[model samples]
Target: MTITPQWKDELRARITLSSVIMRTDKLTKAGREWKGCCPFHDEKTPSFYVNDQKQFYHCFGCGAHGDVISWMTEQRGLSFIDAIKELAAEAGMEVPAPDPVAAKRAEKRAELIDVTTEAQDWFVEQLRGSAGREALAYLNRRGLKPETLREFGFGYSPESKQALPTALPRFEDHMLVEAGMRIRTDDGTTYDRFRGRVMLPIQDARGRVIAFGGRILENRDGVAKYLNSPDTPLFDKGRTLYNLHRASPASRQTGRVVVVEGYMDVVALAQAGIKDAVAPLGTALTEMQLEMLWRMVEVPVLCFDGDAAGQRAAMRAISRALPMLAPMRSLSIVRLPSGMDPDDLINDRGVGAMEKLLAEPKSLLDTLWEFERDAMPLESPEAKAGLKKRLMEHVDTIGDPDIQSLYRRDLLDRFSAFAYPPRQQAKRGPWRGPAAAPKTLSNGARSTLQKSMSGGQRSDLLGAVIAGLVRHPGEISRHSEALIELARHDQSAAPAIESLIELAETLDSRIQTAISAEQGFPAPPVDNRYAFLREGTPPGEAREELAEAVSLLAHKPALEAAMAATIARFDEDPEGSFAEQARLRQQLMTVDERLKAFGRKKAGSDTARDENSVSSDS
Candidate 1:
């Protein structure tokens, strides 16, 4: 049975090269390629590289080069047919049965490719000829260099309907029409499909011309601004990106791929020295196109036009990508400023400005939340509920359970914070009422109150907890519920604790590193009980001690509140209040014992380590 080239291409596209090679050779990510010691030859320094975007691996040391199938044949010593069978099984593809008609169709597809390639050559010649003067001037006005124009194969199509037929008189008219180079009317009349426009050749993965995209040299009253080849044997607009042939290799170098709105945007960015950019062909991004982008880079940046139409386009792409999202595979979006595009921004600012925007593209979830949050007025409860409903609807489209749950949780957290913000404490003015005579307090209650007050006044346990939180702000989420409980019970320390948690919510990796390096909080007290706050503490040990400290701090307020409540009931039920007070006293003692145990454990560990060091020295 003869395996068609199309089937092999499908199999290769389905299987990631690195995944197959990594089974034998341990590869580490080095930018857009995976590098490791050459499996074919022994080497101390790593030189073997595998590129998923190109679906091939090469070794600088041994000069071994091949794709997944070739790798299997060379490494595993499997026959070519055997390798194909194995890969076919893995990719869930069935080998096509031998058929004469299938063979004939494949041959016809090749003829169509030849027709498009020939048409592309003719168009390029026209651009360089006298007929293309206006198109050439238009390109020059757009700031395209001679090399850029040649590199992208920019061309021009004449306005005459029979120009292609006159140029390629040997080819039948039906073949030109089939290749999307000519259009046939209902009355059996044929005309050039893309006429009197600046042309762009859209190629496949192997750099074979499959279709053409045309932009009018000048905006006319009734003419469409852009025109693309309709669905043909070789080109499906939804399944193909505008510049994948060039951008795929460029993406391997930059470790990123960018999606723009149109071919013009792609050209503008390329001219600005940003070569790893592509665009959908006169339509919103589709699943197949997104997958193609992902095959090049883990997270492709979608830089849309900054206008309202661009925003709507961004949302449409986001909606299409959400359901197909996987763990490390997702998209980032760059929202250009209002009334600006890549060309406009690059002209106004410089390449650096465009780079900065691309570098900080918003995450898929972030763009979703921002779009929905400001989609409409959220002033009323009904509007807020509507926002929440819309968010969930988007979340529900996610196919991955883990990703869906995470997006749901993250969106709800943002919604809660937005809808029900923390209530602010009212400021107090001077005392208004006359002072009343102070009542005598029991010795135990007074002592407990003094201790709580002293705990608040001095930077002891509370300060250490705050410092620990600053040191490891990421742990705030782990202890958020406890922190909220602590805030409700202890008003004096509540503000600082709540503020720290709030900061943690917004803290990303860069901000967290800055806070840690700057010593954002005051140094904790030198008390041995606060040893976790000392420098050089291991994260695990510090987190354990911090957890204990938080527990004690949280417990103190609850114990004090219970004891005060029991004391207040003494006038109504003397015997019962006395019993309750005794029980509360026992609980307080237990808390104190636990706090002391923490100090003892730390001191004992330090002593043991010191003795071990002394023994080692001796």
Candidate 2:
């Protein structure tokens, strides 16, 4: 018999998600993580674990685990369709069958809504009880308020082995197992999920409880210091960022999101009246988290702990966040005082102090620029030359000329002492010509080159082709053979061509995947022209100088001699000026490469000519 939609809704409403979790009693908290039994499998010890920051659940023991939906499916023997319907119905809505696609989407959304409401209720109930009172006391000591608590959905998990189970009795043992609340033995018995712990509910962007972080009151060596939900359909640890829902609005208002390292940090921010703050539960900041933060505000503040590891982590975040940057979006690295977290800073120095720091937060480029100035000896010519080269490489990557100019000025100011010649001593010994030396440009050639290459797209179509071929060698073998064959003939295209050829040879799936794009291949910004042109440019040698001049002319003809004079000069002085002759030859090579690339297109048109010739012969 087909179950009516109303019946499913009524049945789901009756199922308490918290009760299901409490039925197993596997979860217990330490400082932050939640430890529990693998509900999907029978195990002696609790191995299923959840980290709110990571937003995922994994069972180190039996390995029977997934996100919330996966857990529900595994434990309840429900198909993905039925499970979504069941969860949606619990949220108190009639399942709308708008269309197959819409129906499926609504079911998924409804399940999340249902699960979120149930978890929120459980958390709120916990905060109202005795154990919740203890948690409240802890928050009070940290200077938090009740209204603040309510706004952030502060909830308490009562300190009872059976309280949650009693509240959610209709929930089946298998459902409880799926929710990361409890585990079952071979005999199929169940108990409380998080015993004797104050719970911190983890919510998604829509403020739904996809997971929980339970804090254990007592110090137990063997027990994990904290407990988290297992990977459920609703959450993935790598993807879940704590306090993002609340922080998003605040970030929108303030134009920044302060990213901390824990749930407590979020509370501290909220308590300090700085609601636009968030943290990852337990894992390192991820690319996905960066993307999420980018969507919310123009700048995301990375507030790392003041220790060495935290600084290292901040650097990593900077590195990851930089590539995702758009024109307006930026990331700032906020280094708290040593031995202090955002929570500690708020508690000791006040939120205003943190805000002040946030206001003047350091940019990654600024930090690296400072580091370069301090680390390098600019006074020496060799040091200055090396510094200029490295700095140019960095400046070349920055698409924004304004930001690049700012960095350039900062670099000059920092290395001013090193960039000039030593002041001559006065004729008399006592006083020198001047205390400071006059500053000079470190390396003019490199600077000029950087300026020249900065004007156009850096994207490499050939590189894109190579990347695609690596990912799908068969695809390259099918369509790009002509292009590859042409590249093989020309020295300039050889590097890009060989890369694709290598991929074709290896036939690696990963390379193929990386190359796959829905639209045309992605070109690096026009500013990246330097990367391609730099290698081809000639150096000090006769042949190298010749090649460099040719490239310069191809890219910027104003720099080269007229075509007729250059050819005549080369012919007459082939014996006299080896360098000039070589340069001319190099120019010819560049022209040849461009023609070949051009010819590939022209060859297609030539096909019509060949066909006409065949018709005439017939």
lDDT for each residue of candidate 2 in 527-548, tens digit (9 for 90 to 100): 1122212233322232232223
lDDT of 1 by residue, 1-618 (tens): 566667778999999999998886799999999999987555799989999999888887545566787676546544466677899999999876648887688789899998998889999999999999999999999899999999899999999988999998878999999999999999999998988999999988657899999999889999999999999989999999988878876775576899999888998899889999999998999998987776556688999888889889989999999999864568899999999999999999999999999999999889999999989998899999999999999999999775687688779979999999989879644322214432333444333323432355343567657766765665666566667768888877666665665555444422322133222333233334455656666777877787778877776677678778977875565444544443354445556667767768767867877888999999
Q: On a 0 to 1 TM-score scale, where does candidate 2 land against the true structure?
A: 0.47
State the C-alpha lDDT per candidate.
0.78, 0.57
lDDT at position 140, candidate 1: 96
TM-score, per-candidate, Cα-based: 0.61, 0.47
